[model samples]
Target: MRRRGPTRLGRAAALALAAVIVVTGCTAEPPPPEPQPGRLVGAPAPLDVTEVYLQQRIAAMTLREKLAALVMVHVPGTDAARIRSVLDRYGFGGVIIMGDNVGGPARTVAGLTGALSSEAGLPVLTAIDQEGGIVRRLREDDAAAARELRGLPASAAEQAFRTRAALVAEAGVLINFGIVADVTPDSSSFIRSRTLGESPSAAAERVAAAVRGELGTVLSTLKHFPGHGASPDDSHISIPRSSIGMRAWRATHAVPFRAGIEAGAPLVMMGHLQFDRISPLPASLSPTWVTILRQQLGFDGVIVTDDLLMLQRSGLPEYENPLRNAIRALAAGNDIVLFVLPADPGSVGVDLTGLLDALERAVGDGRLVEARIDASLHRVLSLRRAASGLVEPYVDCGPKCWGESPRSLALADVPPTG
Candidate 1:
């Protein structure tokens, strides 16, 4: 005979017993352990993730795309869609936001940068020259510049840059092409006013402090590397030539760059100045200088060119070809070739596809080793990944993770932006 189902009262009694058991078991389970201080919770280590992601991305990219990813360009305007179109069509790795690009307020600039960063996984590296003196893009950054900070204490440099970096990050910019590392003692020098310090040691101290100040907020770049004080001429119109020997350079110009690099600056902008004693070519296109930077100084971060267009503007026949300059800059070991372009790139003879094609051909004919392209791509992509917030969020270490509350440093006494 088949057993009858439980009676209504019997079923009710059984359900009640099960509910009590469930409640008791639930209460018995312990909550997860608190995330250890200085460690990320429920996430894989960021460095490992970054390495895996970068390799995967590099392997999947076409030769053209890889070449494009090594380029950073600018489209002049506040029109977000127009600027974004250039970045998207070329698959550029970054964009340099100029003064003209910053149309309205910080929030409005944020909207522009937000549009430029369409790729969520690995956003483009949006940079600006918010150096706070003659080179600031944002109007609100009235913090101490090189002229004032050069005389102040090191703490002052740190305080000033901390505020500057905050303002840059607030505008949604990822990288700052600020922190002029060039040191000069010549009162007549063009870079004198822009130099952080009059001497090498003083510049080194302030450069390190500046890097520290920008540590967590944004990626700090030490610009016009190999030192801009080598010559009195501007790089925009002509290549500055210097007669300083290697010993002199290592003693003087290299000090601040080394300090900045050691202090955790992620990118160093190679200047267009020529140290004739070191190498006849500009530092931006000199393998000797690159090797010196990498091996001697132990700089493993991305090395970017000052501006490829500057070479053309020098009125030199050899440097007039934009495509050729980019190739040389890349071959010389620059990880990223920077171009500050106008709205119409064609007017300046900057053909996007032509540049890519030239790079691919160079690799094909062995002018540029495929391995070199791969190496630079690794560096460039690694920076993009880090800037995209993949590494920082997962890792709890490094200067970028410094969670200290900023000290009360007022900027009221600082002069208005020049």
Candidate 2:
């Protein structure tokens, strides 16, 4: 009864006070929403301009032409003429050089690259795995020449890596420095000794530092995505499996990859190991893993698969067919497929035609999406143009290339700092 007595006046005063509070709060503004884990909040999105140009290019290409881009084969021996013929016939977009491909000096490799690029009428991505330590391919018999510099404390490792990158770039081939090898490190681990320590945060930081340090000297590729450190078996001989769950993976193994992506690493190499919690397929063939990489990790670069032939030879019945594996990799978001000759001596028969036919059929059957193909082709072309300056065109030093002029040496020594 007492409250009812002052109803009208009191009610009016209370309403006015409520309005004032609302206005003041509105002007102050609420705090910004907290970003979710793995979300790319402040990062710039990958440009779509390349995708548009690539679509137009692919639309004009024939089935055979598209198939050629999908296959990246190894060149046997140092015979430049034979390599050139293979490249010209297929219009191959790139070559993965191994020990067999390194025949002569820096000048010789440059000459070979120039010849292949000229005949193909397209800038080619000539790459090598000159990862230091036992993986070094360019130098032989000089153990000091192939120094293992992976696991040095971050600062020293980065400087040494930059020097290594500069040297490989000087050799006239783009490099695939093995930034990450998926082997798990135990208490007495020699392999993990090269890795950036056990913690994912530490690993990611070191890898990103290496990428940033090598920015202008060479193109850096972050390999074996989705955390290869957990794999117990070697993919080279068997299909390795990681017992860790997706949650554990996200917290640990995935840390370095996310860091590398944030640093704008131009290329990411997919691993061949399988994670059973997410998908039965290997990371190279799993859409969840690839989609997470592109969308969540904010990586919009070329994704190349670990060699398909290795999967087939891994003693796994499921990987017996390399063509099917290639198709799966494409569907899973990988942009390139590597087919290299085995290190085993006296091996014959590569079966290139079979691989080509399989890829062709996959495209025809819609197993490999046309849009995805265009996206990948555009990335490849962009990388080629960026690396070789194909669009601008530099001096084509024909045969008597070395030391013809001091100017030539000056030009060659200046590295492409992208």
Candidate 3:
């Protein structure tokens, strides 16, 4: 079949269309630059990279996911299956291993961490209260030097803690609840033996060195904030009262906390001690103290409660209910409330699940705002993200996220290495 050629009018029309395209500069925008090879499509970026990404991750999560990030539950066993059941069900930010959880096996913890972390969406921080000396959890390690901070020089103390941290890190543990910053001079002080010891100056130096020793690998924690040694009353039994005034506190007690903060410790566990003169409430449940920790001392990291169960141990009218205490702690600006329920003598017979249930009801009832959950989750996620290597130290502090702290990476968006 013969094909018909374009007529004069058709050719003229085609020429006119070509001229119009050239004049108007219409060209399909160069095929989007050949699809940009090596670009990461849906690869997870750092949580602090953008506010939208962080929020999206937060939004994508269920209430359980958010709650899991907020609490570190203790499942007391070296049995990998029991631990895996908890992690698989809750997706908790961490698992706090007590002395019982650390059986004599060299690789029990490492094996547990590997098994659980492989199934987790984020890094599951392997936690231990390795205070060394009397409170050492990993006694199997010959190099455990938690008690060595008692009288060692700052340089020596730093080396001791750094060595301790390396040994712990080798077990795949990412967090340490050591470095007691409390300075109590009393011989009978409960935490005295576990602390950096008598001199505030020396305590501060030793605490900061220990913090710096871990650098980015392990998240160092300075615990029992606002100093616990001042009160002879045991917080584990009841809410201890610190009779010291704010002026006295500033001069002495606040010293080690300040130094640890300056050294960039990622977590601070607030004590249940009440500074009656300065603040009427327990430090763990007191907004006044939390504010002091944040604004006055400049601790921008995660502030966790010592144990709601301890405050409940007082059996005082205000401290009885674990559910109420969790609410009060959250309302008081605490990012995490440690409820060692069921295991805590004070928490006997109480449902460990009640904490999350109460929090969920509170959020649903508007007693707690979703934003509050988000803010708490942001700090929580930031810590997890930082610890997981998805973000850098204090990523929210710089120009990223516009100086606002937003620490979360979309699990799907994060690169494979993390």
Candidate 4:
């Protein structure tokens, strides 16, 4: 070869350049750095009860047991034999007790509940209208009972319900169809003294407080949902209607219900009243109102009817027999039917077996869908599961509250009930 400039490359420079290129080409990229510990690192994930569990439970039930689970019947007597007979014949989801059930003592009621529970190992949803004031069956003179709750600070109201829930638990009542959420300011209103009182906002605050208090102790229910102030008539005697339009209804009547739901009330009792402007149908049988409660207000708990038997008293052509009414109630989203026998003498006494028969026929004939029944059946069972008496500390309410000679709390016992 001809002589080139400097004859060849600089040895040190060529060696350094070759070394750099070879070192870069041979090296491997380090793996992504290991993630650092997060704030929630060792905490266990929250339990997620899949819907499959609930569906499995529902699938295991028979048609009779399923339908029976959806009806909450009124048992007239405290006679353990009579009560046991009724229970033995029908597996009612619940039994409602009144003053008649409370003979001399709270133990009488406890005994009734114990007998029912013994007959069926499952916890019976023993309910009462112990709203205090004129609505208390256990303590007829409850003017002071709720006075201790009304207008008090939230903490105080919660504490009061805690004490009251203890009393209710001792009486073997898991559900208190108490905690009136209606804003009927009319002194003549049937729900007058039973209310939390003063104004809607104040009453709403108290209603929520009562719910918080009763949560772990007893299942709190918001009564007469969407307010019972629409019609002046007593729901027990005739069907009532709310005249207020949607805007005003939302503004005034729905205040307490909204608050109660926010406070986590386990159940909302739909009244027999109709809000014509909202839905032509009675609120208890109206899907519109229920959609408002479920979709808008976000109420995911149980929705119970005031009393299906009241349909006969409604005088509305659309509402027929209690059985049909019960089906409508479920279709409209009511999870439980309160089948209180009307005090009206001419009306027929409630027959739960007949009601079950009617429902089975309805389901078989396609008048009521099995899925619709399942919807309600599952809801009722779920509520019983969540708001169970398992946590309650059962004790003797003693003669003071439920004794034959229970100390009177009222100026005079007026057979407390609105």
Candidate 5:
């Protein structure tokens, strides 16, 4: 008893040590097994189609060739030879023609489109923002053209939009880029006048009409989703935030987006605005928004971002560099990331090589699932096929111009709806 009493301190220390060991053992876990390489999972296998054919072609292409395909550059002037060189040098997926590109509307369009397709062996997706009112990209002095197009009240905007879509299809552009369609009067109030109507329901109806009109000739893209209407700032200048929460967003901003998708619009453009309620990232790089657009809304169409380079200029610290945003956008389920005319031609803002490299690295490192890549690629190609028609053998228009061709007249009747 005496010896036990004398040894009590030692026994207490031993018990304390045992407790510490037990706690340590309980807290310890084997290090997680090194993650496996990225592999496709939870995504449908690649489908067989003309798109796969093109992707295979792209896959076989050199990095420069692939980079070339990703760009849709603006031509300096109507110089067909210079434009041809750009096409040849870049092998671009398309050309975006602004007002500056037009000389004689019919001649310029036919000549440029023909050159890109025939000489370069690239079927270009010629695109323009032809939304009427102040945003119209196509213009004509003809009274019929002006008379055919009229700006309707918000209540009648749907019918007007349908008519506008029909007119856009007649223009021979493969893609009709709709601008200010998603803005409302109340939120940002900056894009209010450009919007068809103040109410979400009205906007949705008009958007649907626009989609319906483009079913044959051009694929319609309803832009600035999750509502740029709420932002006071232009995304081109700054990353605007929405004061409305996700619930309000679902009720209002999401209305037109749902309508456009339901109308079978093949493409939707993600906005650069940030929605803190949904995500800290810009809507263009948010999985929540993209997932809603794809799964919740049941939109199977391609999701393209509103110019990553533009977002970089908007003073968003995270998005100051576009390469990160590009990777994030694709990861967030955007099929195509547009880097529309960068301020710096030499820099290009987003490094194409860096973007591909990051994607490749993510695939290698198991961060990005291969299935996701394939899904995006599939959607992109499907849209491309839908946009492109049968590849006719090249006929050099040279000086004679394809505008004189009978096929070009098909666009003449496509009247503008103001």
Candidate 6:
């Protein structure tokens, strides 16, 4: 049996095919190059860089600093330097710019906030109550507020919040205590004018739409949780009381909060409202309400208290102490305790040193568990990280980009170094 070689024609065809293969090898698109270590071509870097960053940052904080970070204070003034000095002196994690703080336009306000935070990696949470309508701190926000949006469609609520959030962000504020998730049908109710909807269902739709509109511009907050519409009284002066049970609440007031959480709101503010049947204490100081908010409503974001100063303004003997209210709020699962202070904080019985000392004592005496404080700190710090855009997937500029090397620069401040 003899093995035969190719014919002349077959040999010529083989040679032509080989030449074609060489030509294709040179001209055709190359296979995706092997992934280079420390180089992110179109691929996303680890998403947990932000989480690691938060954990490391929190781990380095002292007990006093951690407690201070949980408090967001307000100093009434237009002087950026003075406010920043107060923040720096207290080493607070955040500040709320009030009507007095906005001395002029947005650019001027930016200077105030810009001074509040020098670290771009993790900026201090500068917040403002720019709810438009009656509650706005910035007069430049001419967007449709709850008063007008309530009459319009859900899309109108989205558009209005979009415009409002942009104004807040333009002022260099990171958090906007703008969205009023409360609902009430009473035309005489105090919060009626600032509510997005008269009915629960209507409010839910609009609240969700508003959150969607504020998705990327700034951190959106849903206020007066358990709903301010629970009572006709104003929380600023009186502790509003309601008797609505969990069943009735779920069917009515909880509708908007649930919808807002689902729509990705980053913060929920516990109001100083009391539902006696549920808890004798106000929601801001009620563990029952916090449990319900976390377990029942399924909200996992940061929970802050409405102005602690309001508790003192209630004129009640028990609620007169700001330090006590802060401890209770933190112990009850609130991540942040807010204080809106006048130039004279002593006039309202709020001494920053005394408050911090009380918190330190609470932690030492086991009145407020250190673990609970850590949990709240984690949530607050995580929110700050996300708000700063640190949690977004990282991308490498490859070898062609300018400035510092992306990998080295990103890793320089990142955590899990061990």
CA lDDT scores, all candidates in order:
0.83, 0.66, 0.72, 0.71, 0.62, 0.83
| Model 1, span 1-418: residue lDDT tens | 1112223465467578669868788656555544434322222222344565677678788988888899999889999998899889989999999989999777889989998877787889899998898888999889999989989999999999999999999999999999999988888988888889889999999999999999999999997889998788889889999999999999999999999999999999999999998898999989999999999999999998988998888999989898889989999999999999877676664887888889888878877886788899998877777766654323233321222111211121222111
Candidate with maximal TM-score: 6
Give candidate 4's whole-model lDDT. 0.71
Q: What ranges in model 6 sit over 4 Å off?
A: 1-47, 389-418
Clashing residue pairs in all predictions, respectively, total: 0, 3, 5, 8, 3, 0
Question: What residue pairs clash in candidate 2, if any at all?
Answer: 182-228, 204-256, 216-417
How far off is residue 283 in model 4, in Å? 1.0
Clashing pairs in 5: 149-417, 149-418, 188-230
For model 3 the local lDDT of residue 262 reads 97
> What is the C-alpha lDDT profile of model 6 across 298-410, one tens digit per residue?
99999999999999999999998888899999999999999998887667748898888999999999889988998999888877776676532133223222112345445
Candidate 1 lDDT: 0.83
Writing each residue's lDDT as its tens digit, candidate 4 over 233-271 gives 788767777667988988787898999999989889998
Cα lDDT tens digits for candidate 5, 1-418: 0000112354467578669868788666545533222211221222233443556555666544443444455665667677667666556666676677666655446665556554333466667777776666666422121113224443344445555555554554667776345746664466665675557876776666656655665678888887888777777778888767878888888888888888788878888888887888788889988888877889888777777778767765776776667667777877766766533556546554565676667666766566676666556655555555432223322211211222322343322111
Error of 1 at 19 (Å): 53
TM per candidate comes to 0.82, 0.75, 0.78, 0.76, 0.70, 0.83
Name the 10 consecutive residues with the lowest summed lDDT in model 6.
Answer: 396-405
**Residue pairs with clashing backbones, model 4:** 104-403, 104-404, 105-402, 105-403, 106-402, 133-142, 134-417, 230-242
- How high is the lDDT of residue 415 in model 6? 25
Give all candidate RMSDs, comma-separated.
Answer: 16.0, 16.9, 13.7, 20.9, 22.6, 12.6
lDDT of 5: 0.62
Error of 5 at 122 (Å): 6.2
Model 2: per-residue Cα lDDT over 220-335, one tens digit each: 88878876667655676666786788788778777888887777688888878788887788888888888888887888888888777778777678877777887888888888
